[model samples]
Structure formats: C-alpha cells, structure tokens
Target: MRTYFLLCLSIVLAANALSDNLVQAADPAFTHGVASGDPDRESVLLWTRLVSPDSPELELTWELAKDPTMQTILKTGTATARQEHDYCVKVIAADLEPGTTYYYRFRQGNIVSPTGRTRTLPRTAEHIRIGVANCAKYTGGYYHAYDALADTDDLDVIIHLGDYIYENGATRPGDSYYPSFLATGRQHNPPHTCVTLQDYRTRYAQYHQDPELLKLHARYPMIAIWDDHEIAKIPMQKSPSGEPIYDAAWQQRFNDSLQAWHEWIPCRAKQGEVIYRDFQLGSLVNLLMVDTRVCCKSKVDKTEASLKDPNRHIVGDEQLAWLKNSMLTHQATWNIMGNQLLFASKGSDWSRWPGFPTDRNQVIDFLTEHPRINFLITTGNAHNPHHYVVREKESSNILLHEVLPGSISSGNNTEKSRSNPAKLKKLIRAQESNPDLLWYNNDAHGFIVLDLTTQRALVEWYFVTDIRQKQYQVYRAHKLVIDVR
Candidate 1:
C-alpha cells in the first residue's frame, strides 16, 4: 500500500508540472473567443478563433454537455486551428437529443473557456419562440439589441438575415466612426479595408471578437444568410465587380471568402453553395434560407432608364423557382422565408425582390395561387427594423407578412436621403394606423424575437440603446402577430 501511494503521488506531481508548463506558455489570444450556430434537432456547429501575435497553427479540444454547468459530458472531440484556415475552428457535433439544452466549451493549451449553452430544436410543436436580426457593425456602438435579446426568455432560434460584416475601404480619413469605431475601442483587424480572401477572413475574425456577439451566438442556434456586405458592398451581378471579374481569380476569391465564411459560421454548404436551404422546427414551422446574391445578370447602373430595366434579377431565376416550390410544398403549419434584402419596396437600388420585378411578381403570384400558405418573411440589410404587408397586384388582401429585423450594431447609412428621421417617425406612428405599412424603427439598433404555433406567428422587436458606447442597453420595442387561416 505504501509503494502504491508513492507511485500515485509521483504521477499527480508530473501531471501538475505539465499543466503548469502549459499555463506558462499560454498565449493571450482567443480575441474572437467561441460561438455555436446552425443548430438542428440533434446537432450544432461550434466555432472559435485563436488570434496569435501573428497567425499561427494551434490545437484545441471541445466538449458538449447535457447540463449548462457542463458537469455531465455527452461527447467531446479534438480539432486544430491552423494558420492556413485563419485559426478559426468550426466543428459540427451530431447525435444530440431533440428539444434539449447542451453546454459547450473549448480548451487551449492550459486555459478553459467560459461555458456556452445551446438548445436543440424541439421535436414537436408544443410551441417554439425564435429571434431574428442582421447587419451589425461593431463601430456603430454597443450591441444593445444583443444584450436585450440575450436577456429574453424562451428563445428557440435566432435567425440572422445577413450583412454580418462590412468590407468597405478605409472610411476616408477623419471619417471617425465610419472607419474605426470609438466604442469597440479600436478599428477592424487587418485594419485596412478588405478586398481579398485574407481581408475578408480577418474582418470576420475582428467582428466575432465582440463580447456581445459572442454572448448572443453562445446562447441560441442561429439561422443565417448573407447579403452584399458579407462579401463586398452590393456585389450585384457585375456591378462593382471585383478585379479580374471573369477570370478564375475573382471566382476563386469569391469561393475562398465563402469557404472561410462557412468555416467560421455554423451554416452548412450544399454543393459548394450557401444559397437556398430549408429547416424545420418540429411540426410548427419551416424556415427557407435563400441566397439572393449569385447567378443574376448584373444590375444596370442606377440610371433613370435602368431603374425600369424589367430584366434586373435579385433572387435569380433558379433561386426564385426554388423559393416558390418550397413555399408551395412546405409541410409545416407556418412557412417562414429567411430572405436577406427588402421585398416591399422593389425596383429601388436596395436590390431585393423589387429589383427583380419578374421574380417578385412570380412570388406574389405564387402567394395568391396558394391562399392556404401562411407565409412570413424575415429579412435584414436595411440596418433598421421594418414591417410590411405583401399584397397581390389587384387585391388589398394581405397575401404575406414580412418582418425586417434590423441590425444588432449597424445603423442606417442613407438616413438623410432615402430614410430620414421624419419618415422614420411617421412609419413608427403608422404601426397602428397603417395596415399595409405596419411599423418601422429606424433610429435604434437591435434584433427581433419570434414565437410560432399552428395558429399564429408572433415577432417581438428588441432595440439597442447605443452601439457607440461600451455599455449596451436593450429594450423590447415592438411586437406583431399573424394569425394563420
């Protein structure tokens, strides 16, 4: 017995010595921290970024648990964060239980991270609540919207409708807030404007480093889509086309940026594309995430004549067809369209379904043809919250409902021209008065929370107090409900 005890003591001492050595060598990176997304009934995508003094390869271990405290382990795995991939780690874990909450964490050499809890989609329509949002610019201010949404109780999913990051050039010197944010206490990493694969990857790394973003991502499963900002501003067809447009180089950059996005985000890629895909939350609802960016004929310049170019395409032909068929064939009680851009005010430079008239009309026609379809559209790109009614050409009858969840951090850019404070105030008042143009919250920065059942779908909009400050305050600003027929 004495010999055995000594042996055990020696082993424990060796282990302690090793742990101490690792702690001494630990790097104070992980600025981007950890996140989880693309949750399913039984699985989820786990993410983390390890920022070295200079990009360097690192190894990490991750684990999932049944308890928020992570006392009970369900499964665990190992992964590498190589410089070849920007040191961002994404692991898809399977075999989890439905409607269950799981806790996850990552471990570097010697330090363990704070735990994050994520819940799987419920198997049945006992009822599910979800939140939707998009367009968060770290420079804007604090993530009041994220703070508010984080405090929100009973959320099953958080749907982000795009503009996840900005890829603009240096915001002209003295642009102050435009270039680097005052609150984030610094500018974006790769500090210069992004146009290449490295630029895009570093930009995502920078944004994901926000504490508010990390908190929001750690909590709920996110259903996401990409608008122009995810790549470059308004990269419609060929407009502002990146260098070597037709050359394989541009395609390679586009694909590289997309692959990096896929590696960093929780969403899946089908056939090497992030375009259109569907998700079912028990029997209560189905969310169709579509790509409104690729495969379209380039936009005619915003010239007067071009505005009427009945040929401009936003949803593209293939995607539009798929969207219609998906809506028509949905088996769930509620059909939700996770579109990136605005649909109500088409024919505008905004480039939503409106930019593509033929496609927009077809969508309108499909809604009319399928009167039984209880449809709801959740979108981002406006950077502010908006609610509108989708109508058929000849009828005032509301054919569909759209909830434009605003940005978590990003604010309105063209507030002076197209969307000013006066028009915004009017729309806010119109919430109760106008049936067609229900509501709008242009000044605030925040996100939307959604609850769905067989009989109705309800959305609650949360507002962020200020993105320019270190402290973020969130408020529940608005709510809307659509009763299914």
Candidate 2:
C-alpha cells in the first residue's frame, strides 16, 4: 500500500512540476488570436488562449472601450487561465449601451493581447451586417477567407455555422497546407488522436494560433455553433457508449473535450450539457445555435424506407421542442438558425437531414405554420456553399432561405476533379429548381455576408480563389434579397 501511495505521490509531484514549467514557459503571442461571441444587449464574450510553458492558466485582466484607440474605458475585469480551461479566458463585459461598438483587450503581467472590436445588439436595428463561415481544415490551406473578412469593414457580427476545427488527425495530400498545419505550429495539440480533454484543448490551440483566424476574432464579435468535428465525426446518441463507441475512455474524452471547449471558447455550457443556446441581435434577428450531433441519430442508408424513417431525428425531441417554443415566441424580423449541418442535402456521402425525414417534416411544418416568420439558415458542414429555399407548399411562398457557406479550408464541390461535372450539375439543378433552393456553390473557399434591415434582408456570398495559395484571389459573388411582409 505504501509503495502504491509513493507512486501516486510521485505522479502528483511530477504533474505539478510540469504545470509549473508550463506556466514559466515562453508565452506564445496572440498567434491563433482573439475572438468574441454570444453577444447580449449590454455585453459580449471575449476569448484568448495563452501559450505559456510554465502556467497554462495565467491571471489576466480585460478592458472594454468605446472607440478603436480605447481612449474611453467602459468596463474592465480580471480572469485567470489554468490547465482545466486550456489556458483560455472568457470575459463578459456588461452595462454598456445597446447596439453600440466597443474595443477590447486582454493583459497578463504586461503581455497585452491583441486589441479586439465587438458590438452589442441594439433594441431596434435599422441596419446590420453578418459574416458566416464554417468547416475550415487548417491543414488544407491558408485562412485567407478570414483575412478578407477582417479587411471588409462594417460587420455587426460574425457567425460560424460549424466544423470550426477538423478531427481528421492529418491533412490529406494534394493540398498546399498552411503553416498552422505543421506539427511545430501546433502549440497545443492533441496526442495521436483527440479523444481526451488535452487533445481537444491542444486542437483548439493549434487552430487559434493561425494569424488570419486571430485577426477575424480581433475584428468582429462572433456567434458560433459546434458541428460533428467539435467532438467526433457524425456522432449520434444511438449508442449508450456514444459515437466513438467505447465506454469508460471515450465518454471521459467527450466530457473532457466539452469541458475544454467551454474553457477555450466564449460559450456557456454548464458541464456535461450540449451547446444549444439562443442569442438575440437586438430586434433585427434571433440567432438560435443548435447542436444536432449530440443525442441524435447518425445518417441512415440510402434505402427509400430508411430515408423515410419516421422515428429518426437530427435535432432530437428535446431540442425540437425548445426550437418550437422559441420560434413561436420570436418577434424579430429575421429568425436565423445557426445550424451545423446542411438541412437539405445534395446527395453527399455525409449524413444530413435527408437521413432523418420525419423530424425534417416536423420542422418544415413549423416553418409553414409560422407563415409570418422570415427565416435564414447558416451552416458549416458540407464544406461547400449552398443556398436552399424551404417553401410553404400550400402558399407557394418561400419560408426558409439557407446559406451554406463553404469552408475556409475543406472539401470542394468537385468530385476528385474526375467525376462527371454533368451529374454534379444535375444535382445542383434539382436543388435550385425547388422554390426554396435559390443558389448553391459547392466549389469555393469563402464566407457569406448578410445585410439586414427591417424591410428586407440581403445576402452576399464572398469567395476566395484558392486557400492553398498564401495570396488568394476573389472569384465569385452572389446576392439575394428577402422582403418581409
């Protein structure tokens, strides 16, 4: 017993020593960068990860200002970074004016983080601009999409649909990878495969260090949701053991990953809970970010009977209930769903709403019933750009307009650059012919910008020529407007 106790003591001491070393280690600059999310009327959530070797969680302070120079201080507070939180800090600055712009920064013992700018929602929004993006595989290419977003001024908020990070372990070949993908650049990285807290935190650190991502985080207030990649690929609640399907270890890893995610990102998850929450951007829009990967069924086979399963669900019963209640109560001009995966699939190999027809019907029914509601869906998975119109069958009017922003770096519309373009074109055509499906781009590297007013909502798609090249070019643009009755 004494021998066992001695071994345990040794392990504890070694851990403490390692932590102390980490705290004392040279701090990584705001590499992956700064970000803001979950904005309320008077406050917004600010995030930053410190790369110090000796201490992961360092005590830090933050300040909010009314202008770019930060000449006038509005709010200031202190926070700490530790191993539990992957050395990240999230601060909520309150008591500010509604629908106003603010600048913020983090300070740790004179090491000042990059200055970030954010805006709070107004009581009534006359004009608002939103940037939407998803599925950025750092290993695939550069983060020029984010850089372009930073350069394009006048954004009210940035919303990420999902797949903020990839879990594919390594970047596949035939891609010009970015510096952020290199092993050395991964300041905090998952070991072997990320099935643990440390793995998730490390993955976040790796992604956050990319300068382009940091710039966007510094430039705008973001509202984000997590897709399958945040935990594992296409995870469903079907297994009591969960997606990866192993008891003790995988469950612990999932819990740890979630805990670390809450620690690193500007999100509010009360331990073991899912990342399903809602945010209001003044009176202009209601953003409901939902997690469909958890407690849900994976994609079913292509059999007609399976595809028509009445029991399968994507958002599950509880979330669907919450969504119904929320949609009924929403008074905004535009009801935006920050969805993670494509609600309408274009025959991709992945699992999406098509695999769960019953729930899809219910959701469509709800949208149809709420005829007065103008809805927009933003999503990340599919790694391709898609615009679909969910129509109210009886009225023949558009009910929901979905914008699937292509990944900053992920899959493309092309099938290995070898498949018949005509077939893909046919699929695209079918989707567009639907009254609800307006425009879709499966091949591109970019984000979406939405400009909304009380009367109408205008959406613009921004495409980058190539993310593999350090220098990117803009290739395409599309705009759509929805008028609210």
Candidate 3:
C-alpha cells in the first residue's frame, strides 16, 4: 500500500508541474485567439488581439508554417498592436501557394498564442465544400452547430450570413418577442442593449468567450456579412415617411458598431474599403458577399405604392452596378451570392428583397438572360430553412435557387406554425400558392453544408435535435441539388 501511494503521489506531482509549465508558457495577451480569412491564390489575412498591461503599443511576432507542427516556417514578420485599433493586429501574408493549408501563430516575448489553421483558395479543383451558418444569439442557446462544423475536416471555408451577436439584453420570463420558455443559462454581459463602442465590444467579448465559436474560427477561414441585429432591429437610412433617419447620433452609433465589427472579424478590407467583395475559387465558383443593412434607403412598408417605387434601393446604386458587372464578367462554373435576407417575394413583410421589387426583378432578369450560368443565393435571418426556385414571371422558367440555413439556436418556427392546424394549413396553402416555393421547414435549429463540384452543387441541411439540451444529436433533415453541368 505504501509503494502504490508513493507512485500515485509522484504521478500527481508530475502532472501539476506540467500544468504549471503550460500556464507559464501561454500568453494571456491573446485572449481572443488567432484567426485567418480572405484567402486568395497568393495571400491571406491573419488577425490577433494583444492585451497590453502598461504599454500602449506591443510588438507581436507572427509566423506562417506550411505544416501544422510549424517546424518549417514559410513567412515571419513583426507588427505593432496599437491602441488606435483596439490593440488589434492584422497582417497580410503573401507569396503563398494556391490551395495549400497553412498554420499560423503569434508571439510576444516568451509567451505564445494558440495556433490557427487556414487554407488559400484553390486555383483549380474538382470539388469544394463550404459550411454555412447564421443567426447565432448568445442568449438563445449553445453553439453546438459551430462545434460540429469545427470538428468536420472536409469543409474548405465557412460563410457566415450575419446576426453573429444579438444587440438585445437579457430575456425575462414574460418576453413576447422570444420564446421565454426556451431561455437558457446564457445571458448578455452588459444586461442592457448595446449602443456605444464599449457596449458593443463587451457584447463581442462575451460571444467570443464561447469555446465552440472560438474553435470554429481557429479551424477555418470565414466570410461574414452583418444583418439587422448587428446594428438595429430594423436598420434603414430612411424612415417610412421618406425622411432621413440616420441622424448624427444614429450615424455615430453605426460607426461605432462598424469599428468593432471590423476590428474583430478577419476580413480583407483596407482602412476605408466597403465590406462587399468577390472571391474566385479557381474556375469552379465565384463567391460574392454584400452588405444590405448599412446603405439601404427606405424602411419596410407593405403598401402597393411602396413596393412599386422605382427609386428604392436595397444595395445602393454603386453596389448594384458592381454586382451586375461581376455577374457579366465572371466565367466560373457557378456563381454563389452570400446575402443576408430571403430573395423570394412574400406577403406584406417587405424587409427582404421582395420589398425592393424593382432591383430584385432586375437581378432576376439578368439571371434569366443567362441560362447557362448556375446561380445560387445563400441567405440567412429567416431562422428557418427554405428552398425556393425563383422563375421568370411570364415564361415560368427557373432563374435561380435560394437556400436559407436555419438559425444556430434562435427560436424555432414550430411554435407559430403549430399553434393551430387550420392556420398552419392556410399558411401552407399560401406558400404553395407561389409556383417558385419548393421546400420549407421551420421546426428545427441548425446549420447547412454546401458541397460543390463540377457536375452539381448539393446542399445538406443538418438539424440539432434540441436546443435546450447541452448534448444533442444532429441529423440530416433535407437535401437539395442544383445541376451545374
């Protein structure tokens, strides 16, 4: 018994020593961890945040390696993390091989941060897989969907369609907006709505603390765009009465939010560039991401006159022209648009593309003119998964496909859809009334997996069994295919 006890004591002592060494080696300066994004053939963007105790400026050393072990360094550089940019460091690592996986890390003195893995865009490939997600509210539930995607090794990139963090406060027992019965232990940090830069930063820190989300960012490069919740519940530059709503205060708040967003997200943007940009994944796909919440002109109104207005602009005139030019010039096999709202024309809810019918129809006309091109629109903010085949009005020919992934942990549509069978039947009948409506499911909460190839693009929808439970199973609920050949 004495011999066994001594052995156990020695083992415990060794374990404690190892743990202390690890703690001593780690750098608490990088509280948010490392991330990489916006990969082209020859370059990619790397990001990290340094927490300075006394110095306003900290020198951070970054290294890129071709292997996960980082034995062979491809590139190394030094960047200054300054207080002007919230102590955030963004470096562009160039001269990288196309379609090659690389690992990166940051160091300051003897402390080192966690390594992040990212890959460059392929110059040419036979197959590419992407993970799509959106509407992740910290207070809604756990981020199991992100965890699942992080564990999967087949995905080439991740496209996030916004609402990354909700600006609202804690949910009480009697809140009518969200399902109070489904509230989890997670809650916002500020305990109030976010309006200033500090408030937004606090909210972001709270959301980034989730291990699943951090793991996902550490594993894959992400392409993101913001929606309503990031700025306001219903963000519009103009009011319903046709007056400018973005006054000085509102503009400042918007600026604050944008600053925080740009600082945290690993995007390929210069100091003054807009977020909308295009990525060419070799000859297989052309990916375009757009911002819809910032420059939109009018508030949502369901009246006939409001819908028929020719001056209404959802993406502004400049972005619209740019989109058209990109569509006309791209020669890839497939064109995928990362949008924030649904494109199908629906009932009086005019906050989506359906509200701006003129611009929407213009895009549809462009798609109709080019029958050989396979256009796929991936959107979020619906909190429900939908598959729609939009078609030309007169000819009834399919123009494009819109795939919407369900929310990460937001309230399910089942409550509203199952309240009354008669009402549900009426809703279904109304949806089927449109010739373009193909599939709709609001009962589940999950993300989507998009598998692209030279022949066809397959969309697989996976749903978490329950959002209330910590440990849940994800099962494939639906699959849709678009022939690209």
Task: List TM-score per model, in order.
Answer: 0.83, 0.83, 0.89
Put down candidate 2 lDDT per residue, 1-485, tens digits, no spaces.
Answer: 11211111122122222332333346643334567888888778888766656665567788888666667877899987665656676777888888777778777776766677777877777777788878777665788898788666677788887778766575333433323345223322453557766677778777765767766776778777777777777464553222434477767766776676677667656566767877777678887888777656544555776666655567777788887777677688888888876786455523677567677778888877777877788777767777776656576666677887777876575622324678777766776666555666766788888888899998888899866567777644788888886
User: How do the residues 1-485 of candidate 1 rate in per-residue lDDT, one tens digit apiece?
Assistant: 11211111122122223322332244634555456777778888887765454446777889998665567778999888777777777888789888777778777776665566677777886577788878876565566677567557778788888878777654434563553354355555676667688888878866765556766776666777777777766364654332224557667666766766776777766426645778778877888887776545455456656646655566656777777777666567888888876777632344556656667787887878878888788887877778888777787877888888767766563332242457656545545565666777656677887888778888888776666666766777898888877
Which number leads on lDDT?
3
For residue 126, model 3's alpha carbon misses the true position, in angstroms, by 1.5
Q: Name model 2 segments beyond 4 Å from true.
A: 1-32, 172-192, 239-246, 295-311, 345-350, 394-397, 415-437
User: Could you give the candidate ranking by TM-score, starting with the highest?
Assistant: 3, 2, 1
Question: What lDDT does candidate 3 reach at residue 13?
Answer: 20
Error of 2 at 96 (Å): 1.5
How well does candidate 2 score on lDDT at residue 423? 70
Q: Quote the lDDT for 404 in model 1.
A: 81
